[model samples]
Target chain A: MRLCKKTLIWDTSIKWLLVKKMFFILLFTCFIFDAPVAGKDIHVGKDHTIQTIRQGLMKAADYDRLIIHHGVYHEDSLIIDKPIEIIGKQGAIIDAQNHEVDIITIVADSVTVKGLQFRNVGTTFLSEPAAIKISKCKYVTIQNNYIQDCFFGIYVGNSRHCRVINNHAEAAFKEQVSAGNAIHAWKNKHIQIHGNRVHGYRDGIYLEFVNHSSITNNNSYDNLRYGLHFMFSNHDIYQNNTFRNNGAGVAVMFSKKIKMINNHFVHNWGGSSYGLLLKEIVGGEISQNHFEQNTIGIVAEGATRIIISDNRFTSNGTALDMKGNSIDNQVVRNNFLVNTFEVVTNTRYNQNQYMNNYWSGYSGYDLNHDGFGDVPYRPVGLFAKITNSIPAAMIMLHSPLVNLMEMGEKVFPGLTPEGLTDEAPKMKPYAYD
Target chain B: MLKISAVILQNLLRNKAIFGYLVLLCFTGWGMFLYESQPEKAVLSILQIVLLVLPLITLIFTTTYYYHSQEFLFLLLAQPIKRSDIFAGLYIGLAIAFLAVFFIGIGLPVLLFASGMQSLFLLLSGLLLNLVFIAIALLVGVGVHDKSRGIGVTLITWAFFAFIYNGLVIFMMYQLSDYPIENLILVLSFLNPVDIARIMVIMKSEASALLGLSGAVFQDFFGTAKGGVVSILALILWSIIPFWITHKMFRKRDL
Candidate 1:
């Protein structure tokens, strides 16, 4: 009886082990076949089985490529929720039909929308719509897209590691209140905006609360408002961009640790326009920029610890309108050529330092032949002071009395900002690369 | 009147002082363009010459010429010519000679080197200034009998316009700084032809600076087409009114 009972226990144990082995095989097969191992291309066009982008997206799985063929698609409010690539074939267009909605809304990680034309996302006062809107996404790229007449182009919000590259956006709004910005970014981190051309919008590039971003090689012109506007952004670098013919060229306000280099600000002329308006900015480096024919080249208000060097200011209304609130800023190695006023300020005392600048209006001779002027160059003329106090006195610009008063102020060193002299004014302009 | 004016123009052109003045202006205009790389800046330097040296020379030369040509004027007066015709002939002759010299000296360089609306405005203002100063010189010549005293008055007039008048305007502006004195400033600017000419050129060249801060009144007055027309008319009136007054003096004088 004992032998029979032991054999029964061994049989049950062997059956249990076989059952576990079958379960493992079933799970392995499910892992291998249930989920796609590689991304597959899903075609959408007139001849393809998939008739529309929305249907293709519905049929697609994760890690799939939606290939839009060469045709115009009247689609709006298309939401992209999967980590897939949407690539357009040659001449592929997406027309929103002047709809008051975004053309494409991206909410997934590792998504890319490339080489598409988006048009006619109409203006809306209640909502800020865009041609391509990316929110709450990571590793998204919106590249080589042509957007026209959109409220906003390539708007990115609450995003990380996103890139908007090689996109062109244009609008025809005549008023600033009716226009939106191109390449608008808000609360984004690690954003890269590069090689974009934007015009006729309120602002070419607008940033708010964006950090660790870089904007490079953009041509922004003819905007109704600022070409580039930065507010409350930190640690951003913008370089090699051309901003021209905007209401005001570029305004960087309430920002810190900004590096602006090799940018060109041209032909920004208006009653209150400026090539670069820096307000409440701290700890920035502005170098190697060209400011030509601007109303005011650089206006610094409440800015601190900024190093402005190696810039060229040519034919501006006022080269540097540094207010008294801006302190601890260093202006060095700049060439100010033919500006009406080299430096105009509201206060009589200067807290900022001006050194090694070559002013075209400087008449001081260099007898020592050391390439530095013997006399310290006073940039603030007496007329600048008069205009600062009584703005109507600007009619006296280039008057004989104004010229004589400026000369007298130079000899006497009175009325015009006392400590605002360039100690070592360069006799020759520094050659820039 | 035309024949008399032609003879006087010929005589004035032959004078060495006028020829030397023309040469000096040529040197200054051409040398400025050659010295500065930018045509705008060269125009600015030439503007200085127009403002300061042109007025001084025009004042001194016109006064001296009027004094030295007294015998010729008396001879013309003794003829059957109308007194208005004689006065008109003298004024026209002086205007034509100076205008010719200025055109050849400065206007040619401006056309060749820096040809723009601003430069053309400078040339226009310079010509107007020449006419205005010549009219004032005639007024001095007719009003003051003594030659040395007339020359002194011309010098004082140039100083007052070029220096003291602006000084006084500046003082007035500062004193009335609390008020919105833009229109008042405009009125004062029109009171002096030199200031008017200066403002016109500056409005064109340094427009970006001038329009930004001078408030809306100045912007409307100076930054518009109407401003150009109005300023030119004011300058014309400046030239004409002074000559008319001098003409009245000459008509009523006991020669």
Candidate 2:
């Protein structure tokens, strides 16, 4: 009986030992199959085993870092499908040799391109060619790149959480039809485009159907068209950017909840140019902007519930050209200095409000010494009204006839639009930061 | 004629009123340039002076001078001088003296501070304004017999050109607001030398604002080199017509 019991105990112990061994084998196999391998570094240069970027990309695994050394790679249509980081050394150039193809096409998520220079992607009318084209990407970073003379620079489409920072994109094309935008994004979300300088493009920074994007500290100048063009973009914030010498200046159309603050719009003097053109926009905030020497400083057409405050309009042709359809707009606490016509509107009745603004042409006295004029100042001159109706009458500008008509209108208050006066005009200009 | 004009210019240059006018203009021109930070703003202020003060002062001064210089005129008539030569001499003397004062007073400051094509246009228009008003003043002086009536006529003429004609134009524009009066306004602007001068200066300086739709019409007419030449010719005709009438009236007058 004792021998039989000892045999049973040994049997049970061997079964338990078998169970332990099986569990360890299972765990070891799982570790071997599921654990991530450490990413490897692939170098591409004249001396490296992988001499070209295409070879480097081919040999690279997921999450590998491709280090491209300082040399001009005459390559085009280089597609990056794997999630890899491409770090270009100083003087690293990817010359597309005027090819009608994208230089670097990124198609994966979490792909980073840094410190590369792209050149000479030729203009294409049939297809959308870009220097660095990103499609269907997320967490993609395109930073510190220089792209010159390309059709479209850094074109991103259907991207989310992408960053395009510190990029300098320039083109020398004269015609607007031939040139493309420097930084173009379509159907993007959570995009951060900052510290970019774009010049001589059709549009400097353009976004269509983009939401929750922020464009800051960009200097966009001398573009053939708008410096920044927004179409159907919502909840976007653009601040501290300068739009100078652009054809129509910055146009925000079909947008909602846009915040344009602390921007400088200067020298956009042309027949139809505006410092800021807001069309079909709702609930936008434009504050602390400097509009100087523009043909028309701020043009609000079909805009509603826009708060334009604390802006300085100096030496503009028409400081504010509020169209007839614009309603519920508030223009307050602004400084209007030396503009040819202060406020010109197409409507006979004003639905907007202008309050606490300082006008250089305001000749009313502040008898109460309350820093507000006793008399409400009418910004729309009769001649401005005449010019609005009969554009040919603009020849009568600064004429003694116009002056007399203006004086008569002031006394009678009949010709200009009704209720279009600054009720509390400021005695002095606001001190902007 | 040259001898008579030389004497008249010497006699008028010694007048204290002319010197005071020079000082006043100097103070005004320099003060405007110093007060305004922008040369454009200063130009606007100087424009007001040129438009308002210059015409009034020139009209009053010339009419009074014409009346006050009756003895000198009789003295010149008693000599071997032709009546046309005497009239030519008087107009030439007044023109030279006033042009010199205006050039030195406003023109020099403009050249020093705000030297551009715009400022040059301002100076040109201002000089032409002085000549037009001077000729108008001579017409009144030669046509009217009474002293108060001549001065009165000069004042009326200045008022009509400077303020009343503009009021009439505004009235006409308001009455004819429905009609396309752009060409009509352009035609009316030519009739008044003050309007022409004002348009010339303002168009050059404020071309950006004037490049709008209706402004484009004026800009197309005036912004081109052809437009500029036409406006100058119009002003020259304005000056000559009044002076020619004055010369005709003076030649036939029984002095």
Choose the strongest candidate by lDDT: 1
Candidate 2 runs further than 4 Å off: A1-51, A69-72, A89-91, B1-6, B14-20, B23-39, B81-89, B103-105, B108-117, B143-160, B163-191, B224-255
lDDT of candidate 2 over B91-111, digit per residue (tens): 999999999999989999999
The residue pairs in collision within model 1 are: none
Question: Could you give candidate 2's per-residue lDDT for residues A272-343 as a string of tens digits?
Answer: 778889999999899999999898998999999999999999888899999999999999999998888999
Candidate 1 local lDDT, residue B47: 89
**TM-scores of chain A, one for each prediction:** 0.91, 0.91
Docking class of 1: acceptable
* Model 1 bad stretches (over 4 Å): A1-38
iRMS (Å) per candidate: 1.8, 2.5
lDDT per residue as tens, model 1, B1-255 = 898899999898789999999999989988788888778778888988899889999989988888888898899889888999989999999999999999989999999998888998999999999999999998998888899999999999999999899888888988999987888988888988999998888877756344664467777787688999899999999999999999998888985
